[model samples]
Target: MFPKTSLHTLFPTVNFTEITAIDMSVNSDFFREDPLHENLDLAREKITKFQNKYPMSLLANGYLEERAFYNTPNFERTLHGVKEYRNIHLGTDFWLPESTAVHVPFDGTIVIAHDNNYHKDYGPLLVLKHETETAPFYTLYGHLSKESLVISPKGKNVKQGELLAYLGSEEENGHWVSHLHFQFITDLLNETENYNGVAFPSEIEKWKKLCPNPSVLFEEEF
Candidate 1:
């Protein structure tokens, strides 16, 4: 099992003061219903076209929606056959664009940084490990620029707020609007470079128990 740790103890002075404030009400409507549900056929075609054109990430400011936790549909049916059924978003995502510079939240070691061309989910991604006096944890920075994967070394150390990598566009990242999929994980499950931070509706309970609300760590006005 991976070591347990409190996020607070890891960065005593870190706070969400640096982020821009966001109005959840305004953005909430954007995802009220899965865009894919409106018209699956048209949506898929649009997604394909968007994937081929912009092919880059987007840049914007947004906040983490706590309500999204319990709002996910279904609970048990989605994870039925999977060996690991923890489905639910375990991290807080900041809706933004591609090519955005992703800075290190704090001092940590780069555990895994790679790309997934076939998955079309995470796209270019990076994982950093931070060990606090009380516990150790990892952070996932997903949907990043393909160039971000080119780094110094696998186990290189990064300074606080340092440039880790730039966000990728939709084409390079999994087919979605440009945004940074950030999440905190307690256990990596032997995943050297990447781990699934999002879960199916059925796996929500399991993920909720394993992954806490990241907003607790980054509670800025936005």
Candidate 2:
């Protein structure tokens, strides 16, 4: 079984209280209206501008919109009959610049940390393991700087809230705009350090089977 509890219980220094919630209502004055109805484009533009001005990655660029639950795009069907473009995000994104220090939220062994060009989804990534008395769980840090993995060897144990890696930028981070895509997982499918946390609208049930809400562990209500 997976452990669904506050990461703070394991790492006292991870201060989720300092993290702010991002509001994603379309009715907000900050919401930009687009004639093309390409909300993602408008969102990306606004977030990029905000990121340029803020010291930390501003929430404007990559905040989760509840509409994502229903606004998934449609594309050619895969062999599994799953729409290729309809993956609803199962994790929250933190759009920050490259080299943002990624701290471990809890003590765990580095299970997997590697880079691959397979889909370019998460350019370079790291997955750490955490075990509690009740269950074991894992946390994934995506779009990480190349140097982040260079310093830490696989199987190394990291302390709670310790500096794990720095954030990767758009250039090296799977060609997407800068951000850290973090997710919590219960079962890793017998794979170390690599797992897909995103899911097509049709695969929500499958994703839910593999990945659970990370917010439960973070305990920061959005």
Candidate 3:
């Protein structure tokens, strides 16, 4: 049996969905250098402006396709190693105001909650272990406020729709827009508090099975 979704199906009161809540570009250019290349302040101001222009509090940029931005000089600086890097995003980003209360979608165990303080990365990360109808899956919450991880420890159990964490500010959350990188995964690759949120184009097939599409698809209806 497949795992039943808790983020959208289980909780009716919370009003969370991957649907066109904000039409936050279900297919966003995750590594679009055009946006980040020019004056960052103006770019952020526009993004902040567009954030509230929609009804949904989050933008679900679900499993995206590969685009060529890695070889560029500007993007290359973000690389750490000489090996090939994964650029395609694998998670749904919740673009909302800072300090938003992030609720757990299912009853799960807090496997690991640690602050991944890296520039242009997920600041404070938290991963939960959940047992569904068929198997035990994992959920990752990234770009969280530092305080959220400070109080959250390993081996803690959380219920569905519970106040799990808070959104981090740009300065704190890897210097990006304030949002929650919420993702569901089947295999954890032996990782505890961390997992790859992006994937290589060649590995998309394997990842597709692990990162299933949300029932409520975020599309442009308008």
TM-score of each: 0.65, 0.71, 0.75
Give each model's whole-structure lDDT.
Answer: 0.57, 0.61, 0.63
After superposition, the stretches of candidate 3 with alpha carbons farther than 4 Å from their true spots are: 1-18, 21-33, 37-40, 55-58, 65-85, 214-222
- Please, what are the lDDT tens digits per residue for candidate 2 over residues 1-222? 443444344234323333443444344444446422245456567666654555332342122333332232332256565445444566667655567677777788888888744334677888888988887888888888788888656899998657788877666776555667888778777886467645555667777757766666654443
True lDDT of residue 193, candidate 3? 57
> Comparing candidate 1 with candidate 2, which one achieves the higher TM-score?
2
Better of 1 and 3 by TM-score: 3
In model 2, which residue pairs have backbone atoms overlapping below 3 Å? 47-61
Over 1-222, each residue of candidate 1 has an lDDT whose tens digit, in order, gives: 333333223323223223432322223543345532233345345434543443332212322233342332322243345533223445655554456566777678988877866433578878888888877787788788888888524688987756778767767886655567777776777887567666654556666666665554543322
Taking every candidate in turn, the Cα RMSD to the unseen true structure, in Å, is 8.5, 5.5, 5.1
Ranking of all candidate structures by their lDDT, best first: 3, 2, 1
- Highest TM-score, which number? 3
Measured by lDDT, the strongest candidate is 3
Q: Which regions of candidate 2 are displaced past 4 Å? A: 1-45, 48-76, 79-86, 118-120
